[model samples]
Target chain A: MAFVLELNGLTKHYGNIQALRQVSLEIPQGTVYGILGPNGSGKTTMLGLIMNILQPTGGSIRLFGEAPRADHRQKIGTLLETPNFYHYMNAVQNLQIAAAIKGVTNPDIDGVLEKVNLLQRKNSAFQTYSLGMKQRLAIASCLLGDPQVMVFDEPTNGLDPVGIAEIRDLIRRLAADGKTIIMASHLLDEVEKVCSHVAILKKGVLIAAGHVDEILAQDDLVEVSAANTPQLPELLKALPHCKQITAGDAGKWLLHFEQGTADLRSVNEYSFQQGIVLDHLLLKRRSLESKFIELTN
Target chain B: MNLNIPHLLRIEWMKVKNYKAFWILMILFVVSMIGINYIYWYVKQQFVASGDIAAQAAGSMIFGDFRFPAVFKTVSQMSSWLLYFPGFIVIFHTTNEFTFRTHRQNIIDGLMRKQFVVAKLAGAFLLALVCTLLILLTSLVFGLISGDGYFSLEGLQYIGFFFVQSCVYILFAFTLALLVRRAALAVGIFFIYGLIFDYLLAVWISRGTETTLGYYLMPLQVADELNPPLAELKKVIGSTNQWIALGISIAWLAFYCFFPIRKFEREDL
Candidate 1:
């Protein structure tokens, strides 16, 4: 697969603080790649380094198969941290500045603003914009130059639920149009919903990185409850697909099966053949949120 | 780094185009320049009308034999007091980029760090150019209205020197904004340094050297000397002092340009 971005041993130090430590990952083209971490887990610092806003103490970054350069940056749109704009200028004026910087002579500023639903207020001063409007304007600014890659740091931050959903839909549409999106977000559910691939970071270290399904698809959990819960663990232990079984609350036992091996019928049949009756046998698919908590903690 | 001048200038223009404060400050500077020059002309006329010998002598020094070149010198000098207004404008312009975090956003928008510095410098140059042009236009109109014949235009080099002087002050303000990175703090330091610190330092150094050359060579002083107060005061600085002042001013300009670029190149934001 062609990689849109690649990092090798990327490290950053802010005086005594090591913001990023030897982080290395590759983002494949046309994938919604997410850099997930809690606040101050170096998500913003990493994005700043890659965008050349902050100097990396150590590392190399390659975009589009070459070293990062000014021209390379032109092909990538970015919104880091907050919507930074001239408060005295209106939305259209602010986007025009971005268009000029990006070297787009006939920039469809209105099209992008309409996409973000800020076209109506394009002439209003930025200071007069609400928080949501400011955020939408930031997104609109990033859509200039028809860039192939979009880098957003907490894109949906400070938005109402409706605004968040609208932005999420916009991101999905962009990705559908074959744009490679690299977003840094602390919202686990948002990342899980929108990102096709994820890299989880904890304390400046990469804890997990892979396809979302693969990373969250380690095993299917089966919660089986019976009248004799004490005897359930012994029965589950005999099954080859059941890797582990642990007691749960109120005469319930949880069974872990290897990926793609667990099925309700199989577990039921095994219990029936063992002459043990089963009351509850539900397959619990692992969620990204739970996996994230498991890895980060 | 490939530096595209037009592209950089366009970027800078986009920043200031819709900025109300920028226009307000510019209008204030222009209005103050015109208002103060008119007041100075009226006072000079009153001096000429007075019958006292000292008042007549002072009046003649300024207005009695006013040639077009002397008009240029008088008008440009009268306008120089308002340089701090443009200086404040430059300061606010530079600091606004940082205050709004647009400096960082601009980089993310694909501007190289060097380009950001170059664009700001270009903006400063443009402001200085506008100020110089206003001085030229004002002086030309005033000179034509107040004096006779194009023969008064003989000392037009003073106007060119005025342009250079405006650039020096604007770049000095730009350098301060780059170094301080805070609008109020940079403006404060600029005023204190230009009004108090440089004056005291010049006086202290001149006292020790027993020569006023030391005073004239200070950064602001050298630029101020470029368009001396009166036509006769031009002779106070010999040809050698003029050359020294020109050399020092150029050196200061070079520092103001390069030092900020170097510092900005290494800065994280």
Candidate 2:
């Protein structure tokens, strides 16, 4: 994949507090990349550095093969934090200011407003709108000029379920249109569902980075339940495929399989020959949440 | 969006329009200046009507001329406004950013720090220009009753002084706001700078100090001191004083224009 943004050994410090330390990552074009970290873990700091909103004390970042500058900023759209519109101005006016700053002229400000479903509220003052509408307004601002790269920091923050869903759909639709997105979020589920690639940070250090599925994949665990599972745990101890056996709740027995060992027909047959009746058997997989905890922990 | 400078300026102007309080204050300031001039003109008119030479000289001291040529005096009065108002308004600008928390968003919304700074300075300058013109027109009305001529070289110089002072306002207000990063604090400090601190320092120096520092401070020396036509007044104060004040103001303008721009651009907004 071609890298659209690359940062190398990035570091930042305020007084004695280090906000970012040696953060190096490459975001490829057209990928929904997620930066995951807890509060004060430097997620916002890193995004600020990448977007050229903050100067890094050390290291450098390149956007589209050039260092980020005022000219290069036109190519990127951003929705950082809450929608910050002039409280007195209507949605259209707010977007007008945004478009001007980006050097775009006479845009169908109404058109972009319509996409965020804010067409009706385009004439209303931003302070009059609900929090969800405010967020949508922020997204609408980001949509101006159809920028190639988009960065949203905690886009769903302080939104209700419906708002979150709307923003999620919007993000997904934008990604589907071949737009590159770098979303930094503390919400694990949001990142898990929308992101193609993920990077998890703790404190100021990147602890994990890779594709979601690969990062979350688990070694197989086959759960076997029988009428006499209490005895089955003892019976499973002899099998070479069984790395370990544990008694599970509901009278089930868990058989941990060795990595690269998938053939379980022989073990099942042996259980059958031993007069062990299998009520149900299934493989257990790790969820993203579980993997996230494991990785960060 | 292609960033259009004119479009941004227009948008900024629209935002300024929404500030009813600021415009109200502007009107109040101009009206007060006009009222003072009117009162002075009325007294002078009585003396001239009486045909008393001694009274006429005394009346000129009190009322001054109230005609278009008197725009010179109006310019002088308005020039000080240009110098001081921005420092006050700048607190509004800086604090509005903090109160509204828009500075962070402005950074995030793809606005370069340099652009934001320029837009503010330009906006403040534009506001100052409007205020200067309004006072000038008010003075012209006062001059109409006095039957004075309109638009002289001195009057143009008054305009120049007001314009330059407006630029100084832009520099001082913006720089102080950026440095303080808080509206109320910056404004309060500016109030002290304008009202109390500069005067106190000037009095302290003029009384006994050998430093002659009071003459160097623009805010201290310009208090009710007028400009342009005030060359005579300034001369009474000493040519060195004017030069020193100009030098200090320029130094401050340079700091605001460059230093804060660099600092804020590098800072994490």
Candidate 3:
């Protein structure tokens, strides 16, 4: 797979404190990659280093198969931390400045504002914009150059539910158009709904990284209850595919299957062969939130 | 790396285009330049017509045969007081970027750190140019209306010196803004250093050394000596002193430009 961004043991230190400790990641092209971490987990630091805003204390980063530089950054769009802009200037004016910095003479500022739903207020001063409007305008600024890769640190921050939904839809549409997106978010559900791949970070360390499906696979939890509830635990322990059997609420026993075990019918047939009639059998898919908590802790 | 001058200038212009305070400061600077020069001309004209020997001597001494070079020198020197306005404008321009956090945004938008420095330098260069033109126009108009048409190109060197001095002041303000990165603090330090601190230190040092060289070597003092007051224009700065002051002023300007670039290049936003 082609990687749009590659980091090799990237690290950062602020004075005596280490912000990022040898973080290494490779974001494949055409994938919506999410960097999941709570506050102060070095998510912004990582993004800032890759965007060349902060100098890395150690290691290296490559963009589009070469060392990242100012010129190479032209192909990537970034919105770091907050929506920073000249509050005295309006949306169009600010975007024009951004366009000029990107070496774009005739950027479609109107089209970008329209995409972010800020076209009607394009001429209003930025100071007059609400928090949500300011955020949307920041997104519009990032979209000015039609970059191949988009790096957003908390892209949905400060937006209302409707605004958040709109931004989520926009991210999906951009990813559908083959744009690689790297979003740093503390919102677990947001990542679960939007990301194709995820890397969980805790305390400046990478805890887990993989495709979303592989990281939080479907039907990892199976709850089974039968008339012989007392015997269910023993039978579950004897099954070769069952990784762990624990007593659950309401006289049901929870079964955790080993990796790649997705056969519910076999478990049911084994129970019947053992002369045990099962009254209830249900499969529970583990959520990304629980998986994230498990890995971070 | 090849710096795209035009594109960077466009970026700089976009920053200040709709800024109300920027325009207000610029307008006040220009109007003050014209208004003050006109008032001086009116007072000089009245003195010249008084027919009193003392008043006439004072008038001629102040206005000097209003010709090509002297006119340029006198008008340019008169407008020198207005440099602080533009200096404040430069301060505002630089600090506003920090206030708005647009300096960091500019880098994220693909501007090299050095390019951001270059853009501000380019903007300062343009401001200096406009200031020089205003000085020249103000001198030309007042010279024609007031003096006995004894036009000559002999004193035009003062205009060049004035332009250089304007640039030095603007760059000095830019350096302060970059160092402080806060509008009020930078402006405060700029005024305190230029108005009170530098002068006081220069005076104390000059008295101890028994030579004004120490005073003349200071940044603002060097620039100020380049365009001496009309009364002591020739006596205060000799040709040798002029060369020394020019070299020192240029050195300070260079420091102001490069030092900020160095600082911004290494600092984290």
Residue B170 Cα positional deviation in candidate 3, in Å, after optimal superposition: 0.6
- Model 3, A141-252: lDDT tens digits are 8898788899999999999999999999999999999999999999988987899999888988887888987765544678889984697788667675787888878889
Write candidate 3's Cα lDDT for B188-207 as tens digits. Answer: 99888887787677667677
Colliding residue pairs in candidate 3:
none
Q: Which of 2 and 3 is ahead in lDDT? A: 3
TM-score of chain B of each: 0.91, 0.77, 0.93
Task: Say which prediction, candidate 1 or candidate 2, comes out ahead on TM-score.
Answer: 1
- Tens digit of per-residue lDDT, candidate 2, span A80-121: 756677887788777877786676767778888887788988
Tell me, by TM-score, which candidate is best.
Answer: 1
Per-residue lDDT over B1-269 for candidate 1, one digit per residue giving the tens place of the 0 to 100 score: 68997889987888777777889999999999888887877777687668788996777566433347677778888888899999998899999999999999888888989999988888888888899899888888777766656646676776777777888899999988988889999999999899888868876777787777655668887887776666555446332255566667888888888999999889799
| Candidate 1 TM-score over all chains jointly | 0.92
Q: Give the DockQ (C-alpha) for candidate 2.
A: 0.51
Between candidates 1 and 2, which one is better according to lDDT? 1
TM-score of chain A of 3: 0.90
| Model 2 C-alpha lDDT per residue in residues B1-269, reported as the tens digit of each score | 34455655675676666766567666666666566656666677899989989888766654555556655665356336334555566567566776666777666655777777767766776766776676666656665555644444445555555655666655666777888888778877776776667667775776666555655555434423325333444455444444445556566556667876788777777
Misplaced by over 4 Å in model 3 are A222-235, A246-253, A258-285, B58-68, B231-240
CAPRI level of candidate 3: medium
Query: Model 2, stretches more than 4 Å misplaced?
Result: A218-285, B1-8, B46-56, B67-71, B78-87, B148-152, B218-244
